[model samples]
Target: MTMINEPAHTLPVLGEYDVAVAGGGPAGFAAAISAAREGAKTVIIEQTGMIGGIATAGLMSHWAGSAASSVLQELYKRSTVPDIVEKFPWQGTINPEKLKFVMFEMLHEANVHVLLYTFVSGAVKEGTTLKGLIIENKSGRQAVLAKTVIDATGDGDAAARAGAEFVKGREGDGKMQPVTIMFKVAGVDYSRAVFPGGFEANLDVPKGKIQDLSRQALPFPAGHTLLYPSSLPGIVTVNMTNFIGIDGTNADDLAKAEYECRKQMDPIVKFLRDTVPGFEQCFIISTASLLGVRETRHFVGEYTLNEDDILASRVFDDWVVLRAKFNFDIHNIDGPGLDKNGAQKHFPNVDGYSIPYRSLLPKTVDGLILAGRCISGTHKAHSNYRVMPICAAMGEAAGIAASIAAKEKIAPRKVGVKKIQDVLIARGVKP
Candidate 1:
């Protein structure tokens, strides 16, 4: 890997904006659109060509939550494409390409300036506030001056670099959840795949079966295989197995995991072809360009939502978004064999809870807001809220709040939560 250290220099006032959102994933997309739609000069800087982050790049296969109230709903309303119908209880799938176009059109219609292939390397800080960002691109390093910035990098890169406090992996121990190499398989027989007790049904092959399969040299996870329909018919996305104990931030660790996982996929594919029905010609379409990192640095924000709060369906006066499920299928790749042993420890929850905007505001950082999985929350709570839908919801709130703060020429932390809530409510975003 070629790592270049380009010195940060002031670029000719590359225009100003009310808000500058970094990381054009679900959160950044929502933030940029929300800010621009709310009549703020917004600019989105994405490191990649695409707008949808995990949804497009990671090929996440499906959105793991409902698109009802909260920031999630606001996104659908703000989009330029067709509105999403409430047709889900959980584990909802979306067309990545359609969603991408929708996001692109939304930003365009909102008049938000988008800068793709721009990597935000550092922040240009003034005391506690970041006046702009130092971006590295094909043209070299330059500055993007803005009033407020949102750290939707998912890894909390902005907050961390700005000297914010954060916790990575599990508390105390450095163990983290496994990172899945998500891939899509085409030429699948959807009818046969979704059949009762079919390939998808036998996903959670029992230990007896696992042992039997292991002896028979079949390709499968130790106990279960999670697969879902892709946006295209005759295609299915597979998030099965895991690259255990791989640290996403560590290049070497990720490299090894990728190699091992690719090697391991061969047998699994062979097994599916021979043992499973309607998968004889199934093949790996594409692996995620980047690793699907589940957990990383969780920024310590103004509020730390806990698992109990989610279970109790706790609603806060400062709530910015709502969740529909607790951490149901939580997985950890490291520590005490959690992935192998903790599968049965499901949190009791028939409903989800509200997430406060405070969770997005890092306690130790000023003029910087975080969205996505990096927001403040307990481990268990992160499991539920870390999904894409909630992250996008939080992104909307953060964008609106930042814009409000910018317009008032005040610090983000000084912005009133009530004002933010008012704007969200007016926009039909359940706050």
Candidate 2:
């Protein structure tokens, strides 16, 4: 790598905020809403035009883990699909468009300033404290000052740029879980569909057929194709392609991954229509706008959540958030073997685990907090907390913590954990 020198120039300053959140995914959305509801002048900067990140842009139309947070429950209630309870009795399916609108409505109701199509290039820091953020948009480069900053970028972008220590992928060769591109197919024949429990449960479709398809189709890491019924009738979303050994944070790798994943879609779609019964008349509707990066940078926070914490269902004294019943579900890091039978560790008896407030505070960054998958955790633990529901819960906690810090003119790490927990409890979140 080489560096290029450029002439210095003055940059415009955007409006100051009490709490500034980077990323507009489930975590960022919840953080902005929670902070604003707490009377903090909050602003959310999202690179994409829409607020719901993976759910809307990535076409991940399913909600995993228990929807325990009030924010998630509210979004589910606003869903356009009636009888959601009956259709998805356990973890509900989402209509992405409906979710986008609901997120916009909630953010507006809370009066949270949202800057879409804006990218946070880097952080402006003085010693260990982050002073402002360098943002690039259509108007060009500018700065946005905030009393408290939340790194919810999912890749620890803000924290990493602020000189906070972090880790990427698993140990050894640093291999990460594969990136995926989800697509929707319309005109599915539900009446003729032979899915017993659902598409995932259609195991009678012969293993030889899937193995043959995997060998003949475009390079797909997942040994088997998986589909889920969407909120729309006669429509199903496919999660069949996985691009292995690609580092999502690298621009070149992401570009290649996106291209290769799209290339794989046509063959998979053809195979589904020709071989699968229900998809005989199906056609590809649309693919995700963004690549689904399963694992990436995990910031080194005040506390790093480990496998033991998750397995023992540890309750932290500085509890600020909770993750509902879920297991360590690590997808295959490389090559094929990404079926449901891939590497997984289930906690069938455990109810849930508490995520300490310390995990959201970067070890060396002051006035900075983290939300979502970027929070401090080992690779295995990150798998469980990286889902939408858990990320939303973490965001809500980070937002409240940021609000308290801004109000008291204190560092985010110094904000009282009990205060945050209390606010969350009042807002119908389990501490």
Candidate 3:
């Protein structure tokens, strides 16, 4: 490979805050809200126009978490959608848009500063500590200083750019799970479609039936295809198909995957309309605003969680967040092939698990804390904690921790986990 040298340009530092959160996803939202609630001058910088990253932008139907014993329970308790749909007697389903609004309301009420349409490009580091971050937008590139920084970019973009130790893809050549482009189809028939046992059963439709279908097949991005109900009536969101053998961190590869995924969409809609009993008149509405990335850079933290922790349903003394059963949804990385038996594999757990604060604190970085899927955890454990609801809890903890650090004028890692947990408990978060 040939390298070209480009001169680096010097930039001026902008404003400072007690805490600066990069990314406005579930974790980022929670972090900013919690930090502001603790009286910290907090700022959230997001590239997307909306606050909810994947849940809103990708229009993910229902969050993948157990209805009982998890952070999702807290979400339900705080959500207004339940109140709106309470008369229907239906249980457990969050409207992505409503949830996004709820997060926005919380952040607004907490007085957190929001900077949407801004992307974090790089960071200013001194020794091992992050002094500030460089962000770019319509205006120009500017630096935002903060006493404490939390990386909830979901891809560990901030930490990875700041010389933090990280891992990408999986072990043994670093292959990762497949990426999907989720879209919604309207005009589905409620009566004809099999509702099995509700969301879980609807999701776990027998792959044998899917594979053995003699009808017209849905063209997918060279992998497994599956569809389940969204929040709206007579609508289903498709998580079908997979973009295989693509590295998510590479811009060129990611762009190709997105293009390939889009090309596979129409035939999928056609197949569903032709073959699926309920989707005869179903039409393709819209694809996700952003490409759905399953895995990305994993920051190395003080404690790396593993599959053992997931299976054991481990509890930590410094536990700061709660997680429900999602599973080790590792798509075959060897290359694309028919995953006729993919959804059948389940992650058996005794109960929900606790995410330790140590997992969020990088082992090397002194001033930065991590939240969301990028937290210090093994590749296997990442599969479980990578979802939205759990990330919110992690964000809440990181935010409060950052606020405490700012107040005490200490580095984020140096803050006591017990104190953070206490703040979380006070803020109605179950640590």
| Per-prediction backbone clash count | 2, 0, 0
Give a tens-digit lDDT track for model 2, residues 1-431: 89999898888889899999999999999899989989999999999989988988989868777635777777777764544332342336877877888898899999998899999998988888998799999989999999999988888788888999988988566778889898899888876654322222424444345445554564656545677777677788888777888988999999999988888888887877876778889999888997999889988888999878877878899987775556676776756543352333334535788889899989988989999999999888888888888898898888999999989999887888889988978878754
Off by over 4 Å in 1: 1-13, 67-71, 74-91, 195-223, 335-347
Candidate 3: what lDDT? 0.74
* Whole-model lDDT values for every prediction: 0.71, 0.81, 0.74
* lDDT ranking from best candidate downward: 2, 3, 1
User: TM-score for each prediction?
Assistant: 0.86, 0.93, 0.89
Q: Considering lDDT, which of the candidate structures 2 and 3 is the better prediction for this target?
A: 2
Q: Which 10 residues in a row give candidate 3 its minimum summed lDDT? A: 195-204
User: Which residue pairs in model 2 clash with each other?
Assistant: none
Flag regions of model 3 displaced more than 4 Å.
1-10, 66-92, 195-208, 214-216, 220-223, 334-345, 429-431
Regions more than 4 Å wrong, model 2: 83-91, 194-202, 206-218, 339-349
Give residue 236's lDDT in candidate 3 (0 to 100): 73
Is 2 or 3 the stronger prediction by TM-score? 2
Lowest lDDT 10-residue stretch of candidate 2: 194-203
